[model samples]
Target: MLRETWAEIDPGRIVDNLRAIRGTLPAGVKLMAVVKANGYGHGDLEAAEAARQAGADYLAVAFLEEALRLRAGGVTLPILILTPIRPDQAELAASQELTLTVTDAAWFRELRKGRPAPAPGGRKLRVHVKADTGLGRIGFRTEAEWDALVPWLAAPDIDVDGFYTHFATAGQADTAYLERQACRFAELMERCKASGIAVRHYHCAGSAAALRFPGLALDMVRIGAAMYGYYPPQLTPPVQLKPALSLHSTLMQVKRVRRGEYLGYDNAYRSDADEWIGTVPIGYADGWSQRMRGADVLVRGRRAQVVGKISMDQLMIRLPGPCAPGDRVTLIGRQGGERITFAELAVHIDGAAQEISTALTDRVHRICANEKEVQCPWSSPYFQPHRREATVI
Candidate 1:
């Protein structure tokens, strides 16, 4: 039988998380669920549809390709690209009705120069102006730059709709820098007013800001991590967002190691005594980290410590005798009464969650929580006509 490993996404959990987000925010604050990076390692199309159905007003992605994937998947709701898109991709962005992020006048000019025609039903290419303020990464550095971009953004061809900024320290207890960044954003908004730009939607709060400062919630709040059931260490979760991912792998085999037996590359871990070893068919290739060699994974509702090195395609674990081949190992999400967290994995792996997402290989099979078998968006219609017929809406 084909086995599944690593992340498995729960579309039902996505719906529940969106409900939690809706409950936390005030009636006026629109929720923009960030579904980028493949919905933070969860599948994107399902995540987007679930989020939209759960009352999310918008979706936020990191790149144009991701946005395009969602669009191609029949997601008709609004999606905002977080990163500055290359001007070369503007036509596809326009045709697909994906929102573009313009950080400066030059960036706006580049995108607005040769955009595609308005889609049949969708509006012209809509864009949101991002203010760098104090984030120091993307967006206009000063109020003047924002002011200069207003007139062009408000042009007839460009559907300039909103203004947003990022917060560097919104989750901290201090809230001092967040306040300063908010102030700077406010000043820039004022400058846009002076330039006669009609701002349709004004936002600056992210997930942290939405939880930390209720008053700062503007027309929209960009929620990324909170949608994944993770809030900052200090800040409380705005709502009861359950994590939407679970990773599982079956034990490939079992072995008994005598005392002083060494395991794995470089002989990283040695057996202290006669130990029952369980080998899981997962590794760093499946998003498990080598740094997590000593981390506990749930097997048969019991904790088993991972032994020695995490090989490219497999990992050895120390189980308490009873674990055998075909035993399920839970990595991300709950097993029995215990919960394994990505944050915990990050600490053990000496890597960030974003890095973990990028490092995941293609071995992990995605099992949708709702068991959706929707046709792949990337599949061509010519090939589709020859396949078996089934129940499809």
Candidate 2:
């Protein structure tokens, strides 16, 4: 990569994570690998390929555009779009054989009016019914809403592929809310069965729920964050998953500063004593925002505190001692015995680990750890330097 800062993605690690999660699942439980938000910023295509290699039964994205991109990348696994699409976009999604998430009966009415033409082989538009047991986000909330949607789902042109819900407190210390939601979903499933709607799959557990409560893996389990090693350990997950992404950079410039002197913009930091300061070529523009000012990074296996206001393209760190200009810097990974985790960084910003991983922008190039084995599918000039030409998002 041309940039001094880069993120390394290990496809093998993802594969291992998937396998570990799979080991905890019961037989005949399908695994749907969620690659939404660019695989939580680990690179969607790479994650999907890794999932496929590990025998994932299906793939899921948040929008139609994401599913279409995966199809263009030659991913043939059945892809389900988790978020509902515009009624007008139904045809395009159907044309690509993409499954869509349907929440409201009104949406189905709109879709039926602008009906997508039948496929060449009599293929029906596949759909998953989203039920809101809790979280109060999107989905049919009551039995009345489900009843209203039943007739529309019976249409000859559509297929009810799955029925699912999301748990808001799956990762929380309290399981009371999660149990209530699960019970509510169970009631809906029984109602669905009695309705004879012929729903093919039933799922409720996401990564945390699936790992913490295997019984929730009804017909399938949707593994997303945990597949990339981002789940909370407080859940005491049955399987162990390693992070597939790590960030690294080099110390571009290092200099000695006096205690009275200030560093960075607006004199954001003043050295308490004569200290060695090092500059790293990564800042907010690279997804390392100003809130990271007080964070610590690994410099030659030693912890160096970020001592100044992070700029758009660079950040300064208080070195443990005098360090060379070209010394390696570990931002979110292991160096000697020290390691910086996304969870640790997220704690500094009062957020989740996902916020840290997904915040990394495309400006920070990703170097695949095992490029030869699990080739990156992003089509960008930056990856052309590798043995095989590839791209990025």
Candidate 3:
């Protein structure tokens, strides 16, 4: 089945973005590509593979399941789980050789009690201690809390692989808060070092910090949005990034609307004059939100305004002129001389480009394009396209 709506992922573009980011890093600084949220909705396995090929030293995800998915997909790089895992999940995570993050000392004690014994001839579970600094979401918030974890760090059942922290305002123009967070993290690191608890990888820089404040790129950096060609609006990336994902769909129907005719649900839009209208087989269910009613989509390489309330599986676009079904529509990519960027879409939703990309639903097929050819699940032998002419709905 040839799906009308799909997201095209360019691995080459991802590699380019990774390379660009790496180019800006100081020598010996490692890049840990963050592939959480299904690689920001770009397909985790595909994105991780591309990042690995581009020389990412590590890969990070937010959950144990994501790390397991990567391992199952043959990802051999060091995979770190950024989020804390339950005591019950610690053994399974360790069994898969996934690096787990430790936040609270008491929680660590509980995990240690429930954690399964190490496998035969297997190494101890690798762990990274997280310092909360100022994020206030997770990790040890003070020296006392961190000191409480020192015994667990020295336990024979676990190996302390790293220590890290997160920044709350690394991407903003105002660096006061970010500086304070950095200072706190530094103080914690010094305390750890003085206490003879040191790890190889000491990192705090995420994508924003890595790009804006290279000094914070201690041992490694966790890069997410910038690796996918996006950054917060307030900060400028040090290197150019090539977007790896492009959303596209085919027009399913085309019709002539008479003057004063209402379109879509609730009769939200009324045509002021007889005009060409197109129905695209994509809508809120596919991550196109209802708030995008006034946004523009590319039709035949020309901009066409979204005309009415977005539906569950379809939406109406005001075409420039008479058009037929099966015409190509570009939602987030280049179309002839025009382009609809993630930044522009973010403006419509008043969110970051990262949110826009990650919000894309799974109903949309992910077609990965590389130097070889386009690979899609729909291309397999089991899939057969139905022969039917496009018709008005």
Candidate 4:
């Protein structure tokens, strides 16, 4: 890429992670690879292909557009839209043979008004009913809501593909809330049985919950963060997953600052003593916001604290010693024995590992480390120069 900042992704690691999680699952339990948010900013098509290589049974995206993008990219695996779509959009979703998430009966009623024409080969409009057992986001909450939705789901024009819920405390130390949500989901499953609504797949656990509690893996598990190797170890998961994404950049400039001198806007940082300072070509606009002021990167395999309020396109870091403008900077990866992880950055930002990765803007280029294993989707005339060999984003 023309820029010095870039993210290196190893699609092979994603494949390995899915395989590791699969080995821990019971036989016959399907794995739904969640590649929403452009595969959490590691490139959606790349993540989907990796999931396919690892034998994933299904793929899931957050919305209709994401599913359509995947289809355009030639991803044919059964794709489920995790978020509910507008009723008017049903036809488009149906035409693409994409499974949609539904919350209430009213949505179904509206969808039926303009029933989507059968897709190529007469494929039914597949859907997954989401129950709000917890998390308090987009789902039918009570039995009344489910009862109202039952009749619409029974229509022959629709296919009850799956039933699922999201857990809010899956990665937390406390299990009380998670257990409560699990119990509620079980109640909903029983309600489905009583209503004669057969669902092809029944899933509740996300990556953290799935790895921490295998017994809860009813018919399938939606693996997202764990598949990308960002799940926290505190959950005591059975498998080990390695991160597939790492950030790297070159120091654009370096100089010495006197103890009394200040740097950055409004003097957000002041030199404690005569020290070497380096400017990195990444900042808030590039997803490294001011909240990362206290965060650190690695220079020459040594820790360097980010100093001052991060600018829109640049950030300053206190160097260990004198460093050249072309020296490598490790933002989210290993440098010798020292390493900077997403978890560490998350602590500073008070968010999840995904919040850090997903926040990464497209301005920072991406390079696939093992392009030989998974062909880069952007290898076309549009991305020019070294088309056959270069995998850039």
Residue 260, candidate 3: Cα error in Å is 2.5
Of 2 and 3, the candidate ranking higher by TM-score? 2
Pairs with backbone N, CA or C atoms under 3 Å apart (clashes), candidate 1: none
**Model 4, stretches more than 4 Å misplaced?**
116-123, 379-393
lDDT of 1 by residue, 163-242 (tens): 88999988678978888999988888788777776667788988778876778887888888777666654456756666
TM-score of each: 0.87, 0.94, 0.91, 0.94
Question: Which regions of candidate 1 are displaced past 4 Å?
Answer: 4-6, 111-123, 350-359, 370-393
Quote the lDDT for 92 in model 4.
Answer: 92
Model 3, span 1-393: residue lDDT tens: 457887777766778888898998899999999999988988788788888888999999999988998888778899999998887787788778899999777777677576645456666879999999998898888778877888778667778889999998887899999999999999999988887875889999998999988888999999998888888766667788878788889899999989999998999999999999999999898888897789888987899999989999999999999888999898888888888988888888887898877878887877655543323223222112222221111
Query: Which wins on lDDT, candidate 3 or candidate 4?
Result: 4
50: Cα error in model 3, Å: 0.6
Q: How would you encode candidate 4's per-residue C-alpha lDDT over 1-393 as one tens digit per residue?
A: 789898888778889899999999989999999999989878898899899999999999998999998898899899999989999998799889899999998997788677754345565789999999989988999999999999888877789999999998989988999999999999999999899988889999899988889999999999999998888745556776788888888899999989978999998788889999999999989888888998989999999999988999999999999999999899998888899988888887888889888889988877767744665666312222222222221
Q: What is the C-alpha RMSD of each candidate to the true structure, in Å?
A: 5.2, 3.1, 4.4, 2.9
CA lDDT scores, all candidates in order: 0.73, 0.87, 0.83, 0.87
Error of 4 at 135 (Å): 1.0
